[model samples]
Target: MNNNQNIAETAISCSGISKNYKKVEAVKDVSFEVSRGEIFGLIGPDGAGKTSLFRILTTLILADNGTATVNGFDVVKDYKKIRECVGYMPGRFSLYQDLTVEENLEFFATVFNTTIEENYELIKDIYVQIEPFKTRRAGKLSGGMKQKLALSCALIHKPTVLFLDEPTTGVDPVSRKEFWGMLKNLKKQGITILVSTPYMDEASLCDRIGLIQNGEFLKIDTPDNIISQFAENLWAAKSENMHTLLGDLRANEHIKSSFAFGDSIHITIAENYEVEKLIEELKQKGHKKISIKPIKPGIEDCFMELSQSA
Candidate 1:
C-alpha cells in the first residue's frame, strides 16, 4: 500500500464490526476507518446496513460484536464523550415539526450546553440560506430547506466529526449539489465527515468510499482507484431498439455481463474477444444502426462489477 493508503489518525475506527436483529445480520464483520478532515462515504443501496452502522457509531444503538470508536473514545464506554464530539443527522428529518427553524436550532444548542452565537460561525454559511425562513415551522419548510435546517442544527454544537446518514436522499438535484458543497466547506474547517448515500454519482465527491452490500463492505478506495481496478474491457452499446439491444447482448456468448445504462447498455466482453467480432455478432442479431465503443468505468460500473463478483 502507498503512504496515502496507510490509515491515518482515524477520526472513526471499526474492527470486525458486526450487528444483527433476530435471525438476520444487519452488518457482518464490517471494518474501515475515516481519516481526520476527510469526507468518507458509505455507498450502497437501501437495506445495505448503512443506517445500522451509523446507529452504532453514533451510540444510538449497540453493536452485537466487535468494537468501534470515535475520536479515540470507545462508542460504548464513552458514549457521552463520543456524542459530544460528533453530530449525527439521520436519514429521516427528526426535528420537532411544531417548532420554528430558529426554535429548533436553539433547542439543539441548549441540549449541548452551548448557545447559537457560540457556534454561529460553524454553521453561518448554511444558516444564511435558511435565515429568511427562521420563523417558518419545521414541518412547513420545503424538503431542501428542511435539510439545511437539520444540518444547521447538527452543527450547532460544533462537532469535530459529522455523521450524515443519507442527508440528500429526498432533496432535489440542486439541493443535493448544494448539500455536498456545504460538506466540502465543513471539511475545510477540519471536521471529519462520514456520510452514507445510495447515489453512485456522489461517490466521486468523497475522498474515499466504502462500497457495502449484503451487510458487508466489498471494497474501499478513492473513486478513481476503484474504477481503475475494474479488470474487464467495458463497452457502451446503443441501438434503435433499446429493449431488443439489451436482450440480444445478454444472449451473446461473448458478452460477460450487460446492463442498461441511461442511453446505452454497459457491457463487459469475454477475454480474448476482439471488438470487431463482437460487433459482427451483434449485427447478425439484427441490431442495425448499432454503436459500440469502449468507455471509461464509472463508480456505478465498479459497483456492478463488485456485486457481480461477490
Candidate 2:
C-alpha cells in the first residue's frame, strides 16, 4: 500500500462553499478536497477569491453558506480545533515588525502554548538560514528574510495542515526557489500544505493545482494534465512592431483570442485556421521582421483558454 494512502484521507474538504459582500461574490459554489501530505496550489491572480477561500479555511472569517473541514474538524463548528491543528501564513506580513527575528518565533510559540524547543526540528532548516539575523527587527529584514521568519513562526507549532497564501508574492527569484524547496521538505514529514500563488511559473511546482478566477475554479489537475487538456492551436507571433501587431491580431476575424506575452504575442486561432495565412495577414499589414510559429501551451495559455471558454 502507498504510504500516503495509509495515512489520513482528505486533509481538507469543502462543499458548495460560498461567500458574498453585498453585490460582489467572492467565492461561489467552490468544492475541493486536498489529500493528506499533498501540496495543493490555489493558482490565480490577486482578487481571485484565493484570500477569501483561505480566510474561510483558517477560521479568520466565516462563509455565508456551505461547509468546510480541516483535518476532519469543521471550520465553523470546530474552529478551535482547526486553529490548533493548522498553521496559517497569510499573504500580508502579519508578524510583529518591531520584534526581532527570534522574538517573533517565541511569541507565536507561546501563543500556541508551546515552546520553540518543542518543534525546533520542524523549522530547523528554515530557522538556521535566518538565525544570524536573530536580533534584527522583522521590519528591517529584506522581503525574502521577512517571509522566512513568517514561515518559521507558522511552523513552530508543528501543525498538521499548513495554509500559505502567496508566501512568495514580493520575494526574489532565488528566495522563491528556496521557499518552494522548503515546502518540498515539509511535505516529507507528512504535513498537508495548501498554498496560493499568482505566479504561473510556481504552478508547476505543486503536486496539483486549482485554477481560480472571478470567484470560480476554472480547472483542477496536475500542471501537465491542465496543459495537456488545452484544446487550442496556440501560436507565438512577434514582430518589430509588437504593439501594432497585437492590435492587428486581435482585430483579425480568425483569431479567438490574442494577448501580449513578454517579447511576443500568444494567439489562439478560430478552429481549422492555418498559421501560414495568419502570418501572411500580418505581412500584408506592413509588419516587418514578423515571426510566427506553432507553440506548446504553458499553464498561462491553458488558463487563458479556460477563462475565455468559461
Candidate 3:
C-alpha cells in the first residue's frame, strides 16, 4: 500500500468532539484518529473525559458537538453498524455478575449473533487462564480472573475495533502485565484498540497516547515524542526527612516546580540554578542524607509539564 492508502485506512476518527453534563464539560473539542491495527491510548486521570470519549465512540452516548466514526461508520448516523463492529469493555465491570464465566461468555456471543466456538481462537489465550473457573460465578472470581473473562467476552465476536476503558484498574501488577500481553496478541489479529488508563507507566506500551486533563487533550503523540517535548532540566531529590523535602524545594526561588514522586521529589530548576547550592540550603535547614541527581523525564513527568501549561 502507498502512503495515502495507509493514511486513508483509519479505524477510528474524531473531529472537534465535545460533550457536557449539567454544568460540567466532560469532553471539550477532542479530535484524533487511530490507524488500522494501531494501539492508541487515552492517557489521563479520573474525570479527565476518557470515559466520556469512550462512550461517545462506542455509541452509548451522543456528543453535544463535533463528529466521530468507528470502522468508517458515523457514531451518530450509523450507530448500529458501529455497535456491530466494535467491542467495548467499560471502565466498570458491566458483565453478568450473577452468571458463571462460561454462561456470561455464551450470552454475549449469542447476543452478537455469533458463538464462542466460532471465534474460540480469538480469545483462547485469555479464556484459558480463567477456564478452570468457567463454572464459577463472575462476581465471585478474583480481580484478575474477572478481567480476563471480560476481555474474552469482548473478543468473542471478532471486532474490528476494541474500546477498553481502564481494563487493568484494581487488578494486581502481574494481571495488568498479562492483560497488556493479551492486547498485544489481539493487535496481531489486525484489531484496532483504543484503551484509556490513568496509570502513566502504561503509556509507553502504546503506539501513541493522548495526555488529557480537565476535559481537554494536552498533547497527543508517541510516548517518546511527548517526553522529548519536556523542555526542562529535571532532577530527583531525596533527604532523610522526605516528607518535608517537597516544601523546602518548592520554597527555593531557583526551583520552578516541585512534586513528590515516590521516595523522591522531582523538580524543575531554573537555568541558572545549581544543585550544590540547593543541597547546601537543604542541609542548613536540618535535612540530612540529601541526595540529588539529574534524570530523564518519563510519561508522568511529561504529563505534569503539559497539564501545567494547559
Candidate 4:
C-alpha cells in the first residue's frame, strides 16, 4: 500500500508496533489503521496493553520497535507537531483536582496556544452539561461530570484525531450512553477517533474493532464480521443448578467452552455437535430444569474464544 494512501485515507497508521517493560512485553508486533471520520475501538479486558499502545500513539512514550504516524506526522521525529494535532484523554482522570471546571478548560486551551472561545463550538454539546458547575473544583465533580469535563478539555484544541482510553470505565450506564452520543457528533465533524474499553457491549458502536489480549491482537474487523467468524455451534443453556451446570459442561468432552453470561451460560460446543444431543446428554448426567437452544455469538463470545485459543 502507498504511504500516502495511509496519510490521505486514514487518520492513524501503525506498523509492527511493539513495546516492552523490562522482560514483559506490553505490546507485540501490532499493526492497524483508523480511517478518517471513523470510530475504531480497541476491545479487550484489563491488562491487554491498551493504555501502553495509546501512550505511544500520543507521544507520551516511545515504542521499542516499529513505527507509527498520527495525522501524517511521525510519532518520534515529529513529536512536537503531532502533539499539536491530536487530543488524548487518558484512562485515568489526570486533570488538576484543585482547579475548577472553567480553570481546567482554560489551562488545556492555553497549552495548545488557543482559547476556549476559539473552539467552543467543537465542545458545546458536551461542555454545556458541566457549564452549570463551572465554578466547582474538578475534584468535587461527579464521575460523570469529570468525564464530560475531560472530554471538553481534549476537544478545546480542535485536534484532527482523538484518542480516548477507557473514558467510560467508571461512569454509570446512562453516562456511558451519553458519552458515546457525544463521540458520534464529533465524528460528523470529520475527526477520527480511537477509543479503548473493556466493555464488550460498546464494541458494536464503533465502525470496526481490534480484539486485543495479553498484548496481542487476536482479530480486527467489524463487530458483525467477528461474530460471524465464530467457528463452532454455540448454545445458551441454563438450569436450576447453575453452578453445577457450569462444572459439568466443562467436564464434557463435546463442549469446547462454557462461561456465564448474565443469567444464561454460553456454550461453544465441539464442531458438528447438535444442541438436542447436548441437552439429552446433560439430562442423563442428572441436570434438571435444563433449557438449551442455539444462539448467535456476540463480541464477548468471540473474545472468550480467541483468548482461550491464544
Q: List TM-score per model, in order.
A: 0.96, 0.94, 0.95, 0.95
- lDDT of candidate 1 at residue 203, scale 0 to 100: 98
lDDT of 2 at 6: 40
| Local distance difference test, candidate 2 | 0.92
TM-score of 1: 0.96
- Tens digits of per-residue lDDT, candidate 1, 1-310, equal 1422332478999999999999889999999999888999999999999999999999999999999999888999999988887999999998999999999999999999999999899999999999999999999999999999999999999888899999989777787998999999999988899999999999999999999998998899999999999988889998889999888888888889999999999999888787789788878887788889899989999999999899
Residue range 1-310, candidate 3, lDDT tens digits: 2422432378999999999999999999989999998999999999999999999999999999999988788999999988888899998998899999999999999999999999998998889889999999999998888888888888888888999999988777787887898899999888899999888999999999999998999999999999988999899999998888888887789999999998888999888869998989999999999999999999999998988877
lDDT, residue 104, model 1: 100
Top-TM-score candidate index:
1
lDDT (0 to 1) per candidate: 0.92, 0.92, 0.91, 0.92
lDDT of 4 at 117: 96
Q: Is candidate 1 or candidate 2 better by TM-score?
A: 1
Clashing pairs in 1: none
- lDDT tens digits by residue: candidate 4, 213-272: 999899999999999999878889999889989999999898888899899999887767
Off by over 4 Å in 4: 1-7
Write down the TM-score for model 3: 0.95
On lDDT, who's better, 2 or 3? Answer: 2
Q: How many residue pairs clash in all the candidates, one count each? A: 0, 0, 0, 0
